[model samples]
Target chain A: MPHAIKMQDKYGKDGFVALLLESQGLDASDIPGFMWKRFPTNKTWLSTSGDAPFQMTGGGLPHAALVGVDGTLLWEGNPNGAPKKIEEMVEAELKKSKSGWGKGAIAKKARGLLYGKNAFVDAAKVVADALANAKDDEKEDLEAVAREIELRREAFKKAPKVLSEDARYLEGVKAAENYAKWVKGNPEWENEANAIVLDFQRPEIVKELDLEKGLKKILASAGDKAPTADLAKSLRTFAKKNDGSRMAARATLLAAAAEFDPNKK
Target chain B: MTLSRLVRGVGMVVVLTTAALAQLKVGELVPDKTFAQMLNSDGRKSMAELKGSPVLIDWWGNH
Candidate 1:
């Protein structure tokens, strides 16, 4: 954990990011970009953790993989044994991508500008200046970049607001997911976002999370051949236990699923 | 109720996640997919999903 923290400290802001994946015992506060692999069912871990983009198969622990700007794996090894190799690869990657992606020189300049300052107005100006003399096709491409920047900027602003709107509880999980996605990456707005994530530890929220763990255990037990009557009976008891809380509703819904039959229609 | 029982229950989805391929090689494209089979922590975009940038994925476990 200390080594992971040190790595995040070293490269978290400098044209690089890290993901702390695959842990059973962790809170959101453990790492800035802490995450886990999420299951496909609607019964997700708050939909907070992301997909394993690597699609990796059998490999032991304490591993590392370096992916470059174009999403290609550049290196893989046990990080404990090959720190120097990882650092050298990172340096090589930075030369290829200071940040952002674009094929042409001017479009590349706008992308680099967008990454450097994260200022849509200034990045848009870079595009506007180029658009003045750009060919028709080039103009369309520049306009698309400008739109992408604007959408990102809007999402950044909206995420924190969405998080703030939801009271910190089981109900706020979606809001938490949104904040983690959009309000992140920008250093200026990050602290405010982190403040919201920390709120998940509120006693009320923690209680609900504990209850949720129990709920997951129940779902795990029901399996594919769960007796409908038995499952519904368990869900009803869970709903009663959860009464007056937001999760009571979720319990009710899961209870209905226990009773639902797909072939009815 | 038992750890072994829980393991057996989860093994049902093992087909969706576990493919016993060799380790990832350099130059392969990493596709973001179902991570439930893979142990995950909290929530954050995979650096690859953040569009284009250099990313170092540290795949350590809770040891």
Candidate 2:
């Protein structure tokens, strides 16, 4: 299928015109006259040639001026204050054609598609697809690659998330929570998740839960035995002191702590 | 002086032989031909073309 054309905001017509004007050391006012002349209303010009007259505008303009249909500067001025050498234009066109501008848009779309999903699952699908389609000679190596992708995906999936019912999910959730905390930012999910993860038996998860000195108090209360009950009590205490999401997070921590079992066989 | 000159000539021959051996020959297609095809479908054929001679098929990484 022909790739969809996504007009990149970075290469707008204004940028192209600006680049042309800057190169020529002229202003936008200098552009309208020559541009209209070369691309007269009666004459139908290719999109590429449409910008040729704008090249007279020199350095005062922005880089936005030179963007053309295919990213080639349709009107780069020569040293002599004329449009760039015909040979240069021809060479540029050839290079642009060979480079294929449509491919960039396609790649960008593909990248967006990949990043939009949960990274682990999306990456696994990509690897699986690659392996399934690999040549016979490459099939052997692709198995290892597929396995690696699967391993990573499994690790990510098993990693804990805030509010995850599973203990394993807490690991990933805790990491995300820590990251959010360190940034002095609180994503709603991460805050909620952190509360749940903090209720886990893991000391690291508890520490990052940032229950102030309550985490230490809970740790001190349960030395050898499970601190699950102690952690739950501390969470209730913390909840009483905080408001809004923090209160909710504390309540989740209390609930999660009650379910945690340090002596699970 | 004559022995040293002979040894130098032999050394040069050995170096030249090693260089020739290291040079990649034409028609050595990448084993991952299907990958090339997939990449080509996504508009990455030019990369595959650079892998060898004969048919210069290219492939590209989509982002």
Q: Which one wins on TM-score?
A: 1
Q: In candidate 2, what are the lDDT values of residues B1-63, reduced to their tens digit?
A: 699999999999998655433422222322221111110011112222111111111111111
Model 1 chain A, TM-score vs. native: 0.46
Per-residue alpha-carbon lDDT of candidate 2 for residues A38-132, written as tens digits (9 for 90 to 100): 22221111121112222123343222212222322333222233223432443443334333222233322222222222233344444466556
Off by over 4 Å in 2: A1-144, A147-209, A216-220, A227-232, A246-265, B1-63
Poorest lDDT segment (10 consecutive residues) of candidate 2 chain B? B52-61
- What is the DockQ of the complex in model 2? 0.03
lDDT over C-alpha atoms for residue A19 of model 2: 14
**Model 1 RMSD, rounded to 1 decimal:** 14.9
TM-score of each: 0.47, 0.22
Question: Which residue pairs in model 1 clash with each other?
Answer: A22-B39, A22-B40, A35-B41, A35-B42, A36-B40, A36-B41, A37-B40, A48-B43, A53-B31, A53-B32
In model 1 chain A, which range of ten residues has the least summed lDDT? A36-45
Residue-wise C-alpha lDDT for candidate 1, range A5-57, written one tens digit per residue: 45555765565655545434343222222221111121112222433455444
What's every prediction's RMSD, in angstroms?
14.9, 24.2
